[model samples]
Target: MNIVLFEPEIPYNTGNIGRTCVATNTKLHLIEPLGFSLDQKEIKRAGLDYWPKLNYEVYKSFDDFMEKNNHPKVWMATTKAHKVYSDVTYGSDDYIMFGPESRGIPEEILVDHEEECVRIPMFEDTRSINLCNSAAIVLFEALRQNHFEGLNLSGELHKLHWND
Candidate 1:
């Protein structure tokens, strides 16, 4: 699975998400005009020295990303949605896109991919979850639904046991 961040603002959140990608062996794509430089101390601090170890790609623009990836479908996480994330069947090649903290994706883009939009269930009056946390929650569910096979850590499958 892939994680795509569109115009992310917070360095620490991006750093945290980068670390998540590294740990899960997921490819991370950052769409640009980022609020801070990639080498910003705040990003490196949260991501730590292992940031370099993560498999990540930087796209100059969303158009550039679409041109290259051409993902069959993109599952966008938005609050203005009727369907829950668990309602859809996630594929291995699907691109899961998230928007900036302050503002969600533009109306044009969201409307363009309206059929693929999804939202996590939440209690009333709650705004949204943290970017990194939301990404983790969605990604793990996608992986789980796919039986958690074919992932980089699959080889260590035998090591996963339930003590309970």
Candidate 2:
């Protein structure tokens, strides 16, 4: 799967998302006009040693991303969407787009792709969740739908047993 961040503003959030992408084997796409430099130290601090392992690309613009990606199926995450995120069956190669930190995706873009938009259900009191949390939530669901393909599912069991 792929995670696309449009004009992300926060360095720490991007750094956390990059770490997630590295862990999940998901490609990260960052659109231009970013608020922080790619070489920002906060990003390195958040990502730690795994920052270098992040498979990602920087795009000049949304149109540039579209042109290079060959019209891949896109799923936009937004608050105005009707469908719940988990309701849609995600594909391994589907591109999931998240808007900037401050303002969400442009209305024009979301309107044009209304059918493909989704949202994480929440109480009306909250406007939205943090970018890194949102990305992890949706991406993991997508990974779940795809049966967690290309992921390491097994690790050494803990020494203590529940039955003990």
Candidate 3:
């Protein structure tokens, strides 16, 4: 599975998400107009030397990202959606998109692709979860549903764990 961040605003969050992607062996794509430079020291500090270990790519624009991957289906995570994320059938090639910290995806994009949206259930009055946390939660669920057997594994035996 791949994680696509659309115009992410905070470098620290991006760094955390990058590290999570690395740990899960997921490819991370960052769409541009980023708030900070990739070489920014804060980003590196937040990532804590795990940046080099992560598989990531930076796209100049969303269109450029779409042109390359061009997956037939994309699942956008939004609070406006009624469908819970766990209800969807996530495929291995399906790209999961998340928006920025402050503002979600642009209305034009969201409206154009309303059918593809999914949301995590939350209590009333809660705004939203952290971007990195949400990504990790959903991505791991997708991986779990797929059995997560073929994912990268180091030459070491480790105990298996699952969340919920």
Candidate 4:
């Protein structure tokens, strides 16, 4: 699985998402014109020691990304979409692209690929959800659909209480 962030601004959110990517064995992609530096302390602080473990890439532009990757199935997450994320089935190598914290993917791109767009179910009153949280929601759903093929899972439960 892959997570692509277009013009992400918040280092903390990016770091959290990066950590999530490492934990889930998903690849991360960041488009150019980022709001913060990758070396910023906040990113490392949020990502902790797992920063080095994250598999990611930086693209100069969206067109450059599309040119290089050319992935067969790319799902763009946006608030303007009609399809619920859970409605679609995801493949292991499918690319899931997200927009920046402030504006999301470009409207032109979204309009061009409207059919491939998805959205998380939320109350009608709310404008949107957190970027990292939204990514987790959709990414995990895909993982679940695939029975967590490459992900680690443990059947053993760590009991929080002893016999009382």
Compare the candidates by TM-score and give the number of the best one.
2
Which of 2 and 3 is the better model by lDDT? Answer: 2
- Provide the TM-score for each candidate, comma-separated: 0.88, 0.95, 0.88, 0.93
lDDT of 2 by residue, 1-164 (tens): 99999999999999999999999999999998899998999989988889999999999998899999997899999998999999998989999999998998999889989999999999977999999999999999999999999999989966887797
Candidate models: Cα lDDT each: 0.87, 0.94, 0.86, 0.92
Candidate with the larger TM-score of 1 and 4: 4
Per candidate, the number of residue pairs that clash is 0, 0, 0, 0
Model 2 CA deviation exceeding 4 Å by range? 158-164
Best lDDT among the predictions, by candidate number: 2
Evaluated against the true structure, the overall lDDT of model 4 is 0.92
Error of model 4, residue 38, in angstroms: 0.5
Query: Any runs in candidate 3 off by more than 4 Å, and if so which?
Result: 151-164
The residue-by-residue lDDT of candidate 1 on 45-158, one tens digit each, is 988877999898899998899988864578989987667888899998788899998997777889888888889888999999999899999998888888776656535445
Ranking by TM-score: 2, 4, 1, 3
As a TM-score, model 1 comes out at 0.88
Measured with C-alpha atoms, the lDDT of residue 99 in candidate 1 is 93
- Model 2 Cα displacement at 106 (Å)? 0.9
TM-score of 3: 0.88
Candidate 3, poorest ten consecutive residues by summed lDDT:
149-158
